[model samples]
Target: MFSFCWPALLFLPLAAFPQNAAPDAAGGHSFSNPATAICAAWAGPATDGEKMRRFLEALTLDAYVSARHGGTGFNWRDITSLLARVERICTAEPARSLAEVWQERKTAWHRGSWKANTVRCREILAAGDCNEDAFFFGIWLYAYDQAKDGRSEATLQTLPQGGGAMVWEECERTPDARLLDVLRRMQGK
Candidate 1:
């Protein structure tokens, strides 16, 4: 005995409905501020790989989502390139912060001027390296068919078992493929 009016749900505002909220990442750290003094720590030796990866993923993910929701007018195509450019900026001026460099690039570069790097496969998939969390974070980014309000989330319970291994196997065969494309195909999109 179950009954409900499907038409009633359509009138509800997106905010009014419950969403599959993600738990606050990184000890409730608010990475909303771009000038949060991250380049120094990121460039320095990483003592705790997990924490470092979490923070990095969170920061970049925030930026990506912000751009997605019109926070930034032009969204950067992918995390790998965005991070690569951020790394370049960090290397050139260790004192400058992420948001500063991000803003600079926003003004300087065209939206589609650049392409995602293929060699990034090796870097993104290499776990236990200094930049270990990129793979999981990257997966989370593409986990949804549409990244909005966490409606279609890709969680551990939702993903098929051995999915990660399948990605690794595919990546091993095609080292030059786009990470997002690879992930999408593996997800059977």
Candidate 2:
């Protein structure tokens, strides 16, 4: 009954949303070929005009993680966000390979350059649907907290339960609080 979708698909109409333009569902990271865009089918005056096609052959060749009906249970938003970034980069530098640009800006263009802030998290909770964005944000929070505490990785023991319910309960308790603050409190940090 539910479907997986990003916040108004920030990727498709990426130009419309510039950096620091209101907190929306956002995250960024890198993987696969080093090029900014692993496989860019550039076709016209505008890099994103019609006829541009991205085939799965490249994806299948260098597939990282796959998405399932229940979602990948990973910080996929960051990865997806990174691809979106690479796309933008590739558009500007069409001559570069997806891997080439990706390697160049992997660290510089890491996640948080365009992250989904706490306000957006609250809005996602208010909507009453634990979509991928909401769910991944929760996982993102848990992992983020783990990293902040100097933990090498987020283990099952430390990961909070209740998924979207947990986020909803926490966000509702502190309507104006930042998502990281809530996460810290939940983890007793």
Candidate 3:
């Protein structure tokens, strides 16, 4: 006769599961939204030009997804325009750093309560205004949501892009004041 340990069997499922499943390494759980994750990384202190480019690529995909989903209250055209402005900033003279831009924006957001930030994001989303400030704030809100959901670093390296050269070309053609300000700050001007 064989004896089975019932108590040990109860612990089997727990042992099989990851104790702290890392979102970024989830093999099969495709991120529901990658733009937010990329944006979180972009806002962090470690970002560089290459990281900015990657974040832009992920944002483009998110814009497409917003267009396809149709009920998320997202205006895809506005999102595209917003991304273009960000790209322009990245390609500017001296190249604005996303980390710096995020710090500035985060500081501004923190001047008010979280409720105020939420209200501002809602207003921007509802107004459908595509100005640089509004667009940046809106995307920042998305990134904030992703961070809150513990998906900040989940899809940084997995998002797809058509190519980097074309993005750079378009970025060279666009211009933004906020980005210019960052460049100025970096130059001590």
Best by lDDT: 1
Per-residue lDDT for 6 in model 1?
Answer: 19
Relative to the true structure, candidate 3 reaches a TM of 0.26
The global C-alpha lDDT for each of the candidates, from Candidate 1 onward, is: 0.41, 0.39, 0.32
Tell me the spans in candidate 1 whose CA falls farther than 4 Å from its real position.
1-67, 70-120, 125-133, 143-157
lDDT of 2 by residue, 75-129 (tens): 3444554456666776576555554444444442233321323334456566455
> How should the candidates be ordered by TM-score, best one leading?
2, 1, 3
Itemize residue pairs with steric clashes in candidate 1.
none
Give stretches of model 2 more than 4 Å off: 1-121, 154-157
Candidate 3 off by > 4 Å: 1-109, 112-117, 120-122, 125-127, 154-189
Tens-place lDDT digits, model 1, residues 91-175: 6675555555555554322233222222345544453222324433343444322333343321222344455556566767876
How well does model 2 score by local distance difference test? 0.39
